[model samples]
Target: MGDLANAKNGLNIFLNPLYYGKINDNLKKQIVKVETTKDSAYFERIENEITDELNKRLSGVLEDYAEIKGHVSSFQSLHGTISLNKASSLDMVHGKWATHDDYIADWLSGLKDSIESGRPSMMQKIFKIQRIREYVLLFLERDFYRHYKVRTKDKPQENLWSIWFGSETLFWGLLISPRLIEDNWENKPGRIRKVEFGYWTIGHVLKTGLVDPENNTIYKFRDLNDFLIFYESILKRVSNSIYEKQIFAFYVDYIRKSQNPLLEPLLIPEFRYEGIKQKHKYRLDFTILNCHTGERIGFELSPQSTHMAISGIKSKTQTELNKDLALKWGREMQKRNEYFQQYGITIMTFTDDNLIDMKNCFKAMEYYLSKRKADRQSVDELIQDIISIK
Candidate 1:
């Protein structure tokens, strides 16, 4: 019974393929030991005990997998089916008829081999179960799904993506939040109240709507699509340079078409310092959060027009020109350094040359911006089992 308990530890290594290999090897070793033993009846009794426990555990796993399979099947018909080629390294035909037959053949073969060799043959079935289960969970737990879509009693029939953008008014209600006073200083008459205008997460914005106390406007958004339009409109209304417009536009369009739901689509524009008074209130052009890594990044488009422009009618000496040039350079570097020191944000500045090739400039940051899948962790018990056998 103690050996049986030790053997049954393999049951906990569900959905992990490498651990399944370890389990297969362990069972093989147990069979070898039983065959060589003088009093084989005792070892035979232990094998039977282990087999019964394994069967009971596998039965529970199968039942749970079946329930999840139904939800996943329904999800695929609405969105898109999981590619069978992704299931295994085996070359599967693109069509359903061919792939299904191939999969069944492989499953049966694996089972037969396991039975004949006194090893567990359920890895193939478990792998398939885990793949579809992971796919469904990814769809459900993704940032885009949580932020933009709502769980419904009845899911709408049409392609939800198409329907999302079909009408301007589609998801308006979800974004509506009550107007909040961003800044309320001492009630000194003649002092103008300032409302929040920059640097907000989509979740935060949805929870507490943007407020413009001066204009008496409260801004809300329904989905990521609506937020993009709002962001673009903000840039259009401001004095953003052509370089700023082009870079921002490309990033927005890229996220719109990409399937990676982990991307934070909107870059927070005109980011400002909060609850602090400074001699110079420096604000970032655009800021974004890396959802996968939880790193904050700042984008600055420094064209010659804005960054180097010096307006002075008085012509000064060589010393004056040097002083002014040094000051300008210092200011730019200070902004970058302060952001890094205070907020742990890395500022990636794009000059006129870099902005000219926006795609290439973005390529340098593609690693940080892209999706990062979670790494698989090894099971300690499974590792011990392998080490014991060796």
Candidate 2:
């Protein structure tokens, strides 16, 4: 079953229209330009361009796209029905259709008569009406469902593109993170703790929830309308953070200006590295791919408090201190180095200092690239020397 699933995913990758063209360089440049300018218009323009490209490439598969879209539409319609059912209840007396007390009494009397006669009751009729209303609202008001209904409209195509790309496209991967920190209200000190929400595929937006730490409860959005409201709020807050935004900008700038095709860079934020023997994954800050060699190079931006142990910050417990130390220079570091070396990749470490001075970040990358080239030369010389000796 696992193999079958993998096979299906692999087939889907080939079927993806974006895979037919090389988009890495163009996308890198566009992202860099938009990020630098902080202009919303450029973001929309890029999204439209991507949408047009996808539509053009997938023209041959329109029938398939439509078929899949039909399935999605049906599912969303049913979901909207369920959501309405959960959110609304039948109050026959005070219902929208019959608000007057006398009218409601008559309706109930008629409903009771119908129930006795084995006919569909007024209660059933009211429920169907409410269900239809909810479906209409969901279809019209919810962005995701509306996208499918009106793809050619002047709305932003990012979400539509995400659906088509199976949520694994570079655009989505770079902009979002799996883990986020929220204040733990249960703790008296109101410590800000990290929560791993796992991989947030495009579909996740439909049903994402937040935890109420104080009550040990999970609060879910009532519907798509509710979800979008919360999602936009959180997006503005998290995406505006200085560290992530700066890292993203620097990464894009580096890739755009760097001429070395051998060291093709990809910005993978919150990358997950699976452990060899342990059933766990370690999340790194960023990862870049060397396109020519298919080698992965990792970069980690360590904050001063966690890595440098700068004074005057709230003192950490022993376990927290130990974990931080391991991440910085102890067993965790050793394992990461060993793992990367085994695969002939390099992991570069950085601090807040490098982030502040982006020139230092570029220099570090250049140094690594040059070192790799030099190492190749040394290996070639050694091979020639061995051949001469023989």
Candidate 3:
């Protein structure tokens, strides 16, 4: 009974619904239904069965309940710290925490500080779960298909052991769902050729006998370390753009935390201006509006890969033409800058190099805000300046 209790507690922490918030909404809806259902005998039975299997699996890997509780405690502490910080800060300022922008910069800043101070955060746990998920899916897809020939495409009965087991396990259900996988083929002149887009498929597992899609061309891993190396390489390739967006989100979060009624920051605001030729529209990455004075300051992030012509466009044949076009685009960007300056927009640009570190990113923004605060321009004067530019 004690062992069963420990197992239940451990599994709950490991597969908490909160961890799966970023997953598909459909999966979330299904999870809620399962959690809320009261009278379903099948659901209860399936839950108990999954619990028993997971307990048995984890007993082999985890040392004891202490380790599980440690992780759970860390997650709880991190969440509590963020909440406490927000509450305390809002109390100090005697202001309500507004939900208008979905900005929780103060909370995020607290979390980041905790993480940097050697406290555990969701990032570490997320990576651990991702590793476990990969291992489980690989084992199941390979073993189940090879031994029982239970392909998901066969519309396997919901009551079948394999289907029932997968559905009851949260991570398995999230990753192994039929809807999550897609197969693509290219129709060539003589024969159809398989063009890999790094998708998961049972066909690849069964036919090619490959354990992972990422290992198709590379040498197969004989040990855990080798598999981790392969996993990291694939993860890096897929997560670069995601990481860039996360950095942007963190910047927004920092701005939200520093929120003062006197100076409220707006994100990704659209500005309209008439060009010499036609009407032009531009979106600033972030804009700070001084509520007391009504002056606006804009900040733009220009990542080298996305914004700079030297790193962005890459075609051997079009290299010379692209350089010429890039110069033309540069001149247009200059004109936009001139227009913003004419209208008293006080635009500042930061490149990828400037945002390499989170601490540095916040510092740069803080410096800009300070400078803007010191400016003597009035809101009415700025408005008149904008009118004159128009």
TM-score per prediction, in order, is 0.46, 0.29, 0.27
Ranking by lDDT: 1, 2, 3
Could you tell me which residue pairs clash in candidate 2? Answer: none
Tens-place lDDT per residue, model 2, 90-119, is: 332222221112222233233334445655
Steric clashes per prediction: 0, 0, 2
How well is each residue in 1-390 modelled by candidate 3, as lDDT tens digits?
343343344432232313222334654354356435522453454345434444454433233222443643432343343345445422222111112111222332333444457654433232133223222222222222222211111221121111100011110110122221243111123111221110122212122222122221213445433433433343223333543344345544544465331233322222323211122444444444332233456665666656655533455458676776678678647755764565445776677777676466556655544343233333233222222220
Estimate every model's Cα lDDT from 0 to 1.
0.43, 0.38, 0.35
Best by TM-score: 1
Q: Against the true structure, candidate 2 has what lDDT?
A: 0.38
Q: What are the RMSDs of all candidates, in order?
A: 19.3, 25.3, 25.4
Off by over 4 Å in 2: 1-241, 258-263, 275-280, 293-295, 308-331, 341-344, 352-356, 366-390
User: Measured by TM-score, how close is model 2 to the native structure?
Assistant: 0.29
Q: Per-residue lDDT tens digits of candidate 1, residues 248-335?
A: 6766776676674323434555554331222234777666655334466777778777887666727777788778888899989988
TM-score of 1: 0.46
| Candidate 1 vs candidate 3, TM-score winner | 1
Weakest ten-residue segment in model 2 by summed lDDT? 160-169
Better of 2 and 3 by TM-score: 2
